[model samples]
Target: MEERVWTGWNPRLTTVFSVAKTSTSLQALEAELNSSIACEIEYASVYFFMPETCKKNIPVLVKTASTPYLVVYKSGIPVLNTPILCDTLTDNGDWIVIQRRTSGDVDFFKEWVH
Candidate 1:
């Protein structure tokens, strides 16, 4: 796997509050993430507030390794369900890793159904 180093948060980008908790298992983390008010970005490993809520695009740090990411929700805040957990950046959470894919492991031409 190719390691992508995180240089730090950009000053111009909108801040993303860390709402993730430390999870003991992948299932637990998935459940937490799905219930939080966040969305996954394509290049970054961290979750950020949804575009509709934030009203702007927020850039996050990238992590290339396979890891579990945590999620937490404030009381009374609406929870949104996001089932898929594919990330392309390094995460800083304490959860079990369920699946990992190295470079060239995915077949782009193959039809995948989950």
Candidate 2:
């Protein structure tokens, strides 16, 4: 038997690629991700969030020239589709912005089910 050195927990690292202003639709976005070598190698799962529309049953905005959209990946597959109000800003690739506020129009203080 050989002596073994114990190293602390080494979590598997993953990369998230964010597209700011390119994709026009979900299909387009998926195509782009499929074409990207980096995404293909790193992808495990993805979550897509789109801006909400006022119309009762309108389609969500997948990408915009001025707005930002996020694509989260894990192990190697796409897992979820949700809706968000604003764009996400990843600070120094360490933190993900879930929401940003510039006005009091939308209330942040609400119940969990709200």
lDDT of 2 by residue, 4-113 (tens): 32222222111112232333467787877778966755332223343232222234434455644433332122353443333344332323336567898998789988
> Candidate 1, residues 37-80: lDDT per residue as tens digits?
34444312333431212111223233223443322222122564
Worst lDDT 10-window in candidate 1: 49-58
Candidate 1 has an lDDT of 0.35
Off by over 4 Å in 1: 1-66, 75-114
Top candidate on TM-score is 2
Error of 1 at 52 (Å): 15
lDDT per model, in order?
0.35, 0.41
TM of each candidate vs. truth? 0.14, 0.18
